[model samples]
Target: MPIDDVSAGHRQELRRGTVALACLLRLRRPDYGYALLEALAADGIDVDANTLYPLLRRLEKQGLVTSEWSTGETRPRKFYRTSDDGERLARDLTQDWYRLDAALRGVIDQGES
Candidate 1:
């Protein structure tokens, strides 16, 4: 395979887990799916609706997120927010992410030495 193809696959793999963490953190402030997508994009996390919607559903199912319909708008939309459990999970995951990042930096520095 070409270098671009190989890099794309690795990038996809690296990003796969970050999406869930990003969603949980972003949804701490209630938002509908499309708006959430925009917000995430603005924050530099690019996630497709196909990927985000299903992740939201799974998070809701797992009790990590709560949702309610807003009917006051011309068009009803379901808004989602991270639950307390989700906040805890996000905290834990963030700490782990930092630790992993530090470890990776150390490995890279060692390799360069």
Candidate 2:
């Protein structure tokens, strides 16, 4: 049976918000859209192009990432890298993620106990 639409939609929205942070965290090295999508999938992010492409554009607009067209390949591709400002934000977000995860785990453990 399929999950209720409301619950699935909510989960998707939550996952959508993390795409930027995940991209910022992963793009320490320059990567093109398809390659970055692969990397994100390999790391279990599971995002679709519909979600990622617009997120990339938005991040670029926000000055959090920089991109350039690479002509070295038969098909030119735009490679993106996190900006210095993005790096700093990623570092702070990483700390926050760790703390939040630990706190949530503690609550789960307390409930279990």
Candidate 3:
């Protein structure tokens, strides 16, 4: 049976924070918004392009990412990479993610058993 709308919405909302972390980690390699969106979805972190574009802009504004237009390509695309500060933040956040993952797994396992 399908998850109810409230459960699905809550699940999506909880994923938003992880999506930011995923983008920061994945975009250590330069990528445009669409490519990053595809990569995230491929990795089972499905996020909409509309949401990603704005989040990228916000990250840039907050000095967590750097971006440039790739004029070398036939179609100019803006590519973004994690800035030095972003990399540092990602490292720290990754540690926290591991802790959170462990804690959540314990809770899930308890529910299962």
> What TM-score goes with each of the models?
0.95, 0.89, 0.89
Instruction: Give the top-scoring candidate (TM-score).
Output: 1
lDDT of 3: 0.92
Candidate 2 Cα lDDT to native: 0.89
State the C-alpha lDDT per candidate: 0.94, 0.89, 0.92
Off by over 4 Å in 1: none
Q: Estimate, for each residue in 1-113, the C-alpha lDDT of model 1 and write its tens digit.
A: 99999999899889888999999999889999999998889999978889999999999999999999999998999999999999999999999999999999999999999
Model 2, span 37-109: residue lDDT tens: 9889999998998889989898889899999999999999999999998899888888888898899999999
* Ranking according to TM-score, highest score first: 1, 2, 3
Cα distance off (Å), candidate 1, residue 1: 3.4
Identify the candidate with maximal lDDT: 1
Residue ranges of candidate 2 with Cα displaced over 4 Å: 1-3
RMSD to truth, every model: 1.0, 2.0, 2.4
Model 3 spans with C-alpha error above 4 angstroms:
1-3, 111-113
In candidate 1, position 98 carries an lDDT of 100
Q: Report the error of model 1 at residue 21, Å.
A: 0.9
Candidate 3, residues 14-61: lDDT per residue as tens digits? 887888899999999999988898899899998988899999999999
User: Which residue pairs does candidate 1 place in steric collision?
Assistant: none
